[model samples]
Target: MSGAYLEMRNITKTFYGVKALDDVNLSIKKNEIHALVGENGAGKSTLMNILSGVYPYGTYSGKIILDGQECIFKDIKDSERHGIAIIHQELALIPYLSIAENIFLGNEQASKGIIDWNKTILKADKILEKVGLREASDILVTNISVGKQQLVEIAKALAKEAKLIIFDEPTAALNEEESDNLLNLLLTLQESGVTSILISHKLNEVENVADSITILRDGKTIETLEKDVDDISEGRIIKGMVGRDIVDRYPKRDIDIGDIVFEVKDWTVCHPLQDDREIIKNVSFNLRRGEILGFAGLMGAGRTELAMSIFGKSYGSNISGHIYKAGKEIHLNNTTEAINNGIAYLTEDRKNYGLILINDIKDNITLTKLDKVAKKNIIDHNKEYVVAEEYRKKMNIKSSSVNQTVASLSGGNQQKVVLSKWIFAQPDILILDEPTRGIDVGAKYEIYTIMNKLVAEGKSIILISSELPELLGMCDRIYILNEGEIIEEVDRSRATQEYIMGCIMEHSKEGKK
Candidate 1:
């Protein structure tokens, strides 16, 4: 066997008296794309955190060897001194700063404490060219699309002269084409002798680019599979991560469709920052009882804008809409009003919008419906605990206890808490926006099962998703939106992924005119 460029042996970490990593081990070859896969809360991130020096050297009991030398890093910078760079999922770029400025924010081109603008721009432009980004380095980070911003992040890593780059859910926010581009870039980087450790829930992407796959489960190493030796498949990897075979990715719903329970008419919303720009244009839709109605569009297709505006005008300005519930027109002036009127919205940006990170699981679960656990405006602590515990068990949220902080939980468990919050509110119409964005396949199936359960109980659902396969699998009918307009409506029988993509493309072109 070839000597590994990086090796972590028998690593263990603890937080708040809980073992986050239990004698974990990892080995990566030089200039190879290595994938790390696991269920949420399976300790994938924790292991990576140790390697990145986020936890520092002494905090975790481990032996890290790079290039046959025993290494100890006290902090991130110490690791970076050895040419290690980690690009986070949420993106660390300052939005107001120029792309060049962001790329060299800390690692600046300077001589004797004096800034070198010419060198900075020249070096930044060269890095951009290397990454195949066509945008000028002077462009503000905010002015560029997310895909372009990702390239800037790569440029930032390149600036550090990194040999080993770690990418954590890098393509989670990107579109399909953008994801493909990023994967191709990773492959290209491999040819240039840049080693990578990819942490992602997207299994297909892992299969495509990874030369070796490492499966972690319950804070321990499960197995490592080499691409050329082991028969690597999504199913095989999933079975390793989950410890069982998943016969179905999407659960079957046997509920009967009922009469219209909620309806929207002539909904028009202007951008909050730019009043002249309409975010949602004359959008009309209805959800039937016991039905999963879908809204499909690419990024910035006004699907999220329409959902937010309809749910008590949470987004946009100058909104005009007629919302009806059970044949009676009702006005929802705010989020509370929307909830009281039998409507609930699950925000796509779960960390920023859907959750209060500092609070514990129990508190966050019952946060939306404190009234249900209260008597005479006084919260019943016992009742609140009971309710939270019930949802925790029901949602199968993997946590130490209900008292554990939501922030400390994994992304999948955190999402469950959010779902529990809204589900506790007991709204008739649930607008789920990207319900399974970055969760693992096991978690996705569980969520899909929950969706089925909700619809079977005669509830109405409006699913807004960027993934066409998800829309096709779970939705009864789909509405395709383009440039703030619903250009096409497809029934379940006719809603293939190809058909949906074609509709989106065709409508988007016409919208540009």
Candidate 2:
């Protein structure tokens, strides 16, 4: 309160009579990178939404003080007018629009009611250059990589001359290199006199970049730590966020790996759009019964491509692969075929591909296999409700009821619903792609425990993740993939982050030759 740039005092919000944020207080200094850390549903996003004016002044009770001036933001535009901006996890740019147009979409550079194309492109180019993006302003946003698109979002925020920018899960979709680059850009922006509020589950990034950190649990503030004045270790932040010390980040499980139960042989997939470009190059791997076999690779290394193509030909065209279950060859031409053959693939981008966000939890849970809750070829709503209710309890999904819309749940709860749907399908082999991405530490542990339970029941899993530590800790064996090829394999005891990175770097360098 002394001289903070922004002060949110006694902020409170409720949904359907349930408190989402209660008497939350946050103080962010000028030109500083402040981090908001919390478990899922801990009111971090809610508070940001209010600050960004997604929740209007009348909806939430609060005192928003900006530089000693009290203010009320009626909407997003109002907040933007006050030099506050928010870049959501999912970029808001239009796919078909050019980068320049998307940057100045609402806040356009115009003369006499007409958009000045030349001015727009020039301004956008400068902003993009400031953010260290090399792409041309006229290029379509969809044509660029996801990392570049993230930079475009920052440029958009800068276009409004945002003094305080909020990033919600900014690096959730980025790989290690891209994440590092973004963090560096944040530091550069700090030097240029812009304050940033980063909401992320990645504690390492918080520990590295944040000047101050605030921890929220449930709907209230737990504590705030100043990096220079307090012990701001990741463990300390995690303890505050979860309200307890987590001795083990990854739960240790006994390895009881059995014989190979699922196999993919000579899998080759060409790019779906570019017929001559190969995406997967004769990748061969196997998953043993009761084993968690991991695929570790950098972004665009074809791990997701291999998993999707084997699961159902979901990712590539002109796919050639041999998949075997119990030594018997299985031809899976579509997702239905894969599911019927006891295989399920959980997509990495769950918000876009997995659950129907508009649907209720009950509907989403039984969507995979309606026959289980059907009679005489007709879906029994009562039976489906009972089945969904049981899984909700089993999965420990947090919601008001099974009738609650999946969109209303937090990221972690939505993931649980996706798992529930697949678990209800009773697939023997589950291919999880970036399963723990964008979720908090507590939710991650719960999912890890569930994975162990699945393997103990003799089910096999193919884990494709960018996190080498997760792979080393959970998988029985790890495969290093680089540029669509399996470069090396390491057993659990032999796996190390440095070794995996070395393998990828070696193969990548040779490929460039």
Candidate 3:
């Protein structure tokens, strides 16, 4: 085998007595898709941070050798100067800025003490075409779809002439089509001799694309396997990462469905932006107490939009719906009214709509229900701490302290914080949208337990998920949504992958009919 293009040796990092990285080592080949697999807090990000200069040379005990020579990165700029670019999990792009401006924000094509707009646009356009993002350079970052934004990020890296691009959960939020496009793009980049280090929890994608895979567990390197290795299955990778064979990644749960507690009738919601379009066309469903009602749909099938519209018209321009909680009509025109009327929505995009990143866990937990921890507009710090502390333990949030910044926590913990905030509101009906989207298997099991516990307490849950297995595993009843309509509802006893897929096809046929 050829010598690694980049190698990290004896990487040891600590944070207040916690060994974040315990003598970890890694090697990556040139022009190869190298995958780094690990559970959350297993030092994947930390190791990447060290390499990308998020933790500068002096801060961590490690020797980074690139192209057979020692390298010392004092800052992100120093690393970027050496052609190392990192596309973070949460994308960093100016929403209001045009794609050209965002792509060439720092690396402008300026001349003679003046900003050259034409040259900048021209350079951005060239890089955009290189990344297969043609004709999108003039569109505002906000106007483009998320898939395109991701490509723009790649274009930005290409603009910097990035030799080594590190994607930290690049496809975590992307749908199947977008993710496929990105993987294909990565392959194209590889063929063009650009090395990539991908950190992801999606094992299927890793197994499909990665030339080699390295497993990290509890901040220590386990082992690295080549793509053609004899035992490079998903189970093998999971074992290496977790140090044990997980016979079943999706935990088993018994379904005990009961009486209907929530129902929506003729739920017609207009598109939030396009006034002429109707997102939910006369959708209707019933959710039982002590049962999980899964809303299954493909991307853009109006599942999320339906949940948002039902949860106090959070996203519809023109809405007409009738909701009954515990068999009684309720008025929930806004989020406040919805919360007061025993409804809570845990958004799929947690960072944007769910948690305040800069705020501590305590502050975030009390955000939804400040009155419970406040006396006449005065927040009781002790009470707030007590409440946050309780949920942190209850939800098994792995954080240094409740005082720790929410931004500093892992994706799983951030999701828990979001759940804690909503649970504190004590809603009778809870809507969970892709709760386990980017989390690891262990974290997902914890969330599933939490869901079971919620149902045990007699609260109704509406789970909106893209993963069919999750819906089949957790929900007592599943509703198949297709193109802004409820095509079919299958009970837990009768639901199958084939039936669900058929429902999707049935809806398509009806639309064509």
Task: Give me the candidate number with maximum lDDT.
Answer: 2
Q: For model 3, which pairs clash?
A: none
Per-residue lDDT of candidate 1, residues 334-379 (tens digit): 9989999888899999889999899899888888889899999999
Better of 2 and 3 by lDDT: 2
lDDT of each: 0.90, 0.92, 0.89
Model 3 stretches astray by more than 4 angstroms: 115-122, 375-377, 509-513
Per TM-score, the best of the predicted structures is 2
Over the full model, what C-alpha lDDT does candidate 2 score relative to the true structure? 0.92
**Which stretches of model 2 miss by more than 4 angstroms?**
none
Off by more than 4 A, model 1: none
1-513 in candidate 2: lDDT tens per residue? 136999999999998678999999999988899999999989899999999999999999979999889989999999999999999998898989999998998889999999999999999999999999998999999999899999999999999999999999999989999999999999999999999999999999999999999999998988889988999998898889888899998888777888989998998999999978999999888889999999999998999998888878888898987889999999999999999999999999888999999999999999999988999989999999999999899988988889999988889989999999999999999999999999999999999999999999999999999888889878999998988999898998888999999998888888889
* Local accuracy of candidate 3 as per-residue lDDT tens digits, 109-156: 788778788888888888887788866577899988778899999999
Task: Give the C-alpha miss distance for residue 212 in model 3, angstroms.
Answer: 1.5
- Candidates ranked, most accurate by lDDT first: 2, 1, 3
TM-score of each: 0.98, 0.98, 0.94
Output the worst ten-in-a-row residue range by lDDT, candidate 3: 248-257
Pick by TM-score: 1 or 3, better one:
1
